[model samples]
Target: MQIDWVTVAAQIVNFLVLAWLLHRFLYGPITRAMERRENAIRTRIEEAEETREQAEARARELEQERAELNARREEILEEAREEARRLKDRLQQEARAEVDELREAWRAELDEDRNEFLAAMRTEAREGFRTLADDALRALADTTLTERMAEAFAARVGDLDEVDAERLRGAVRRGEGLVITLGSDVSGALRGTLTAAVRKAVGDEVEIDIPESSDDFTGIRLKAGGETLDWTLDAHLDRFADRLASAFPTEDARETQDDDANGGRGAGDSTLGDSHGGTAAGGKGQASDAREGAAGDG
Candidate 1:
């Protein structure tokens, strides 16, 4: 342990010098490099946060677009369905109207056919009855029947009204001359009787002309000017035909005949009956009486 104060001071100076060099060269450079690295890391973190927020905003926009598209699709589908329903209703209505029109046309055709058939049947029946009656009358006719008819004609002339008598007288004065038409020739005695009756009714100077027997009719017709007196079997048969026609009238005529019947009007009167010397009812009775009397005399 000798005294070493100088050696201690030299060692303290060396240690101080070494500390200063290490601080200047190592500690100062390391601190600056660490601060730069920290700043770069903070910038990178801020960029990442901004990118994430942008991505979230884009996702929200895409979701909204998808929702709008879905709504549009639903609306389109609903519109299509409504249009289809409307079209179906219109088609069904048109089809029903066409079917109704066809049915109505068929019904009208059937009605027309039915009316035609009925009219044909009526015409055939009327003609057949007329033919049969004509044959029966021809078979029953005889000379005696002709004489009785002539007698009936003479009686009818005697029963003429004043108006008819005056008309005949006027026609004779005008020189039209009376014409007596007969269905068949009568005996001389019957002719004379008819002639006497005509002279008694009119003036004896009145000319009476009797033509040859005509096959066109089966009755007696007396013509003077425009007036004619018919007392023919054909006239009686025409009244009967009128009655038959009224009984079996066509659809249109039946309605009118029914109306007239309800009004208490006779259906048997016709132009043929009017042409005779009496009303239809009176002529019918007289015709029946004449036939009976002729038959009894035969």
Candidate 2:
């Protein structure tokens, strides 16, 4: 433990120098490297925090977008429902209107048909009553007024115009001169009256061919060799029909002509030379031609 001051001082100096060297070469370098590593780690942590904040903000924005899309879908569904309701209401209204229109049309048609049927029934009833009354009057006249019947026939037939009256009178005056075939009955009282009227009207003597008795075929006949005028009930009927066809051309016209032929008037097809009578087929003229010379005697 003896004191060596010089050695002790030298050793202290050497220790100081060693410590400096270590700080410079080893400790100083280690500390500096550790400080650099800590600084890099802190910088990375700051970048990670910024990135996380950005992710959170992005997630909130996406939620808002999803909410807007749901709202848009609901609005579209509501619009579709409204459109469907409007379309349904329009179709129903149209169908109801069409049904009402059809019903109205059917009702009008039914009313027209009913009215026509009633009119036809009324006309038939009137015709029936007239026929009954006329038949009764004829029954009363047959016993009491045989001459009156002749007078009545002459009067009715005489009402024809001058031309028609002349034709009938001419046929009656020249009666028997035109007979080709002879039937069972030739003359009736009505036939005689017509013959007498014809002589008076046309100033010609008419000789009539009359059969013995009235039978199936009956009428006054006039014949002259080849030419013949059959005032038979049947022949006069056909001529009457042809004449009516030229005039009114109705079904009753045929029956009326038949009656005239049966009553002893020769109803051959008569032509009117004096009058300009139009036809019903042309639809240009009235039925006034019936009162003209075309239907003269018959």
Candidate 3:
């Protein structure tokens, strides 16, 4: 095919003009629309990505919150359990202390009651024994016991200590006469025996006198100058009562009785004469000049 240069040139020029027109109108508008659409899509994609990141952050926060809440719950539960244990132990301790205190109080009460009972029994027994002894001695008053007692008492009087003997001797030298007083119940034989004993103990030439007394005891009392000696059955019995009181004293009276015993030595003590059974030896040799002072009137 032969090429026509002018027609080809003209056709080329027309095509170029048409392409330019399309570019300026249709192509330009289509390209701009497509670019705008692409921009919008990109914007939507970026927004979706930002939303996804925010969701992920929110999920992480929720997960962390849940973990912390779970940890807090566990800790609270453990604390509550420990508190319960401590409370239980405290209550148990209180209960044990209360029981021990109650037991101690009961024991103290029992001991007090026992001591009271024992004291009461001791008092009863002591009273009973004293009554029995008094009755028996009264019944046996007129027996050989009296004679033997009188002899023993006279012997004790004869065995005076050096100090008492000296006192009696000095009193005899100063005094006018010796006085011998006998209990009203004393027998004639006893009076004669006592008179002989006095003469022997004093001196062969010493004065002897026997006087009557309104006492109920079968005892003798001797007076020389200002010195007096009593050896009465009543006195012996009183000494016995004192000994009995000491031996069976109660708690309340023991302190008082102990003080009395320690304060001074009484007659019938174990030192001068043997007073094993409430018997006291009463005698001393002291008489005035050689004159016998008849006791009945003088």
Candidate 4:
């Protein structure tokens, strides 16, 4: 085959024209559009990746906050429980102390009541014993003889102190003599013995007037000329008190010596009886108490 140069040249010219036309109409636009589409897809993929990362970070922060919140709740609950326990213990302690105080107070009140009741009972018993003694003495007087009593009484009246006899005389009329007052209850029974007691105290020649009073006044009242005497049970009690001068038993002899010394200082022993239940100077003892208290002031 002969080389077709003309034909080849002609064909090459035709292809060139067609290529230029395609580039202008189709290739150029297709290439530009494909490049723009690729850029848009790449931008979308980058935006999706950034959005995922943001979501992961947000999840981590939320989980950390939840853990802290849980811890705070646990601490608050523990504090509340501890406070409640402390309150309960304090209430219990106060209750126990109150109960103890009440018990002590009740016991003290009961003891006071018991002591008061016992004291009242003791006072009543003492009164009853005194009442019984009064009843017994009255019985003895009813059975004694009267005639023999008169003789004995006359003897006692003569022996009593002159001053004591004088106080008894005060009760008698001017012409009469001294007087002796016996208890109305025991007058008859004591009449003989008391007369004997007085006769033994004063001299035998003294006149006697024995009268009875309701109370215990086993004493003489004498009113001789102008002077008067009073010897009563109250006076005897006063004298008996003098005998027990000091409470100490060691002072017995000293008291007797003082009584004698004081007796020597005065004019004479006007007092009835000796220290052992003798007659006193009746009312003179009231004045002598001042002297005895001064002189025998041991």
Q: How high is each candidate's TM-score? A: 0.40, 0.31, 0.32, 0.30
Please give the lDDT score at residue 15 for candidate 3: 100
TM-score of 2: 0.31
Q: Rate the local accuracy (lDDT) of all candidates.
A: 0.69, 0.52, 0.62, 0.53
lDDT string, candidate 1, 1-298, tens digits: 7868897888788778877877788777787777788877877777778888888898899899999989998999999999999999999999999997887786667557755655554556444544555466567763355676788788877887676678778878888888888877777787788878888898799888888888555667777877666665554444554555444455555557668768856654563356453333544465554444333433
- Give the top-scoring candidate (TM-score): 1
Off by over 4 Å in 4: 1-59, 128-298
RMSD each, Å: 13.3, 18.1, 16.8, 18.6
Which residue pairs collide, candidate 3?
157-283
Candidate 2 local lDDT, 1-298, one digit each (tens): 6979999999999999999999999899999999888888887887788788888888888889989989998999999999999999999999999997887786667556654554454444434433454466668754322244335434543554576545555555555242223333233665566556645544555554433443333333333433333333343333333444345433344567778668856443444321124223323321222232233324
Q: What is the lDDT of residue 21 in candidate 4?
A: 92
Pairs in steric clash, model 1: none
Residue 208, model 3: Cα distance from true site in angstroms: 2.2
Candidate order by lDDT, highest to lowest? 1, 3, 4, 2
Worst 10 residues of 4 by lDDT: 289-298
